[model samples]
Structures are given as C-alpha cells and as structure tokens.
Target: MLVRMGKNWEISEEISKLQGKIRNLLKETGWSVKDFADKYFWEELDSDGAYGDEDDKSRHAEKVKKHLSSSSSTAKRLELLKKYVEFIETSRLYRKDVMPLRRETASGMQDAGFKAAMRKLSSELNELLLKKS
Candidate 1:
C-alpha cells in the first residue's frame, strides 16, 4: 500500500519565508547576485574542467594530499575551508568588476554614506569568512 501524502502547503510556506529572509538579508548586507554567482564559479569550472590541469590526475592527487594534511580538523572541514577561500577570492574579483559602477553612483549622488555602507559590508563579510577559516 503506497499511500503518498498530498502536496505540503506548510513546506511551500516555509520556503517562501526563507526566500523573503534571503532577499532582506541581501538588501541589508549589500551583497549582490554577481557576488553569489562568482562564489559558485568553481562549481561550473569543475564541471567544465576549464582549467587545463584538470586532466592531470597526478597533480590533482598531490593537491588533494596537501589539503588533507594541512590541518588537524576532519577531512570535511579542511575541504570546506578550501572551498570558502576560493569563494572569497572569486567574490573579490566580482566586486572589483563592479567598482566602477559603485564609484560612479557614489560620485553622481554625492552619497558618501552609501559608499561607506558598501565598504563596511565588504569588510564585515571578509572578516566573518576569515574568522571561519
């Protein structure tokens, strides 16, 4: 007897609430979609093997060994740390790409507050990530 429950409205409501929270957080934190996209760039790169070294199994094994031996934490934590560092670097690159627009907007509106807010947001995010590392 396969008795499947009907669609769960409660789950949908929870997801909607989460989406709203994420939107608000992004707005308050000044985190842009481009930054999030860059954080995920490595996933795309891994799938596409854009890096020529992906084909070199020996090099990959050595790199994996280095990561595994670098810390006393569990292997999962070490891998997470590596990914977090990569994500931060990628986000910095994405932020740089939008620097011109940021400058232009600040200058046009004479909004030092907006610029300062952005600086604070970037510093806070970096600090949080570094502490995690």
Candidate 2:
C-alpha cells in the first residue's frame, strides 16, 4: 500500500509539472498576441491614412476585437504565436534594431531636449521658407 501511494504521489508531481508548463505557455501566448497586435497596429497599418476618422478607427478596433475573440483558445493562440514569430524573423525593418533612448545624457537631460531643439529649428526654417515664398 505504501509503494502504491508513492507511485500516486509521483504521478501527481508529474501532472503538476505539466500543468505549470501549460500555464507558462499560456502566459507567453498572451504576451505574443499583444506584441503582434501592437506591431500590426503601430508598424504595419497606416494609422494616419486609413484610420483617420473616428468611424474608421472604431471599425478597425471592432475588427481587431473580433479577431482576438475568435482566436481565444490555447491551441489557436499557440498557432498564431508561431506565425508571429515566423513573421518577425522574416520582416526587414529599415532601421537598425537598437534601443532608442538608453539613459540620460551626461548633462542630465533626456534626448527629448535634443528633439525639441531640432523641432524648434525646423519650425524656424519653415517660417523663413514661408516668408521667402
């Protein structure tokens, strides 16, 4: 009877391990889904052109919601996650893949200051161009 109990305990331990793996896989699947949607919405879609109006934006949101609802199962999520990984591996972004802003500059200012200065200079140049026109 003790030997049989030991075997049962071992089985339960193995089942627990498998359940943990499934849980982690589900979490990873969720992250991948969000990442894919983020890239699709921000990088792939032309937001300013196609989703300019409120109606267009709502329509696109509905489409996204519908698609996500349809792919709610774990198996579907895994399949989509695999495709997302494949797509990311194949896509060629023009810019080098590097962290945009790592930390503050030596002067204790963020890169936003540099960006703001450049924007100010651009606006001044645009004003001059308008005057010349």
Candidate 3:
C-alpha cells in the first residue's frame, strides 16, 4: 500500500511494524470505525479537494451526519473534523502518513500561526495520552 504512494517498492519488516503501530494507534484513538466517518470527510476535503465543490461538500456533509449523527449537520461537522484532523495530522507525535495529510490540510489554514496552533493542540493531546499511561 505504501508502494502505491511512491517509488519505494521494497517492503521492509520495519515498515510492516510501523504499519501495525499505525493501525493500533488508529484503533486505540477510536479512529478505525465507520462511526468516525465524519473525520475522514473533512480530512478528504482538506487533502484531496474532495469537497471543494458546494454540491460535493453538501453531499459529503450529509453522509457525515448520517454516519455520525452526534456530529450532525454538514457545516458544523466539517468545521469540527477539520479542527480534529488538523491537530492529529500536524503534530510531530503522529506517524509519518499523517505529515503529508497535515501539509495538505495546512494549505487551507494558510496562516502559519493557525497551523502551529493546531499542531500545539495535537502535541498537547499526545502528551495527555502519554501521561495517562
């Protein structure tokens, strides 16, 4: 799967281990299920231009609400998901795949200060989790 992203066709044991770690992190952080689908909606919008069109955004937002009603409504959910994925992807503590996504999302934020602020939130959340253990 990583190979599809780039030219490094070689799959190392270390990379496999890292993949496992990322999967575990996703599960532990409650990011693995469809229940968290709204999270992906905003991230996709930020990273892939998936929701750039108003029609697409509205449809995706409806899907988000259908999947995660607790965070219902397209606009509010997009805002929340953007905030959450931004924090998670930008923080140094998250895995490498997160960085590319973070950089993409930062494009929307535009301001370095806002991006940094989101990163700080991410770092704080990571710290809090570490301390809990």
Top model number, lDDT: 3
Task: List, residue by residue over 1-133, the lDDT tens digit for candidate 2.
Answer: 4554564455444444443443354354443444445555554465456655556545655554454444233544444445444444333321113212122224545487786776677668655544542
Per-residue lDDT tens digits for candidate 1, residues 12-31, read: 44444444444454354466
Error of 3 at 80 (Å): 23
At residue 97, give the lDDT of candidate 1: 43
List ranges where model 1 is wrong by over 4 Å.
Answer: 1-7, 41-131
Q: What stretches of model 3 exceed 4 Å from their correct place?
A: 1-10, 33-41, 47-133
- Tens-place lDDT digits, model 3, residues 1-133: 3434332322333333433443455565656434334455545454666456656656765664453334233444444544544544443335444332232245574588888888788778756655542
Error of 2 at 8 (Å): 38
lDDT of each: 0.46, 0.46, 0.48
RMSD to native for every prediction? 13.8, 14.0, 16.7
Pairs with steric clashes in candidate 1: none
Error of 2 at 42 (Å): 4.8
Q: Which ten residues in a row have the lowest lDDT in candidate 2?
A: 94-103
What is the Å distance of residue 93 in model 2 from its true position? 16
Per-model TM values vs. the true structure: 0.30, 0.26, 0.27
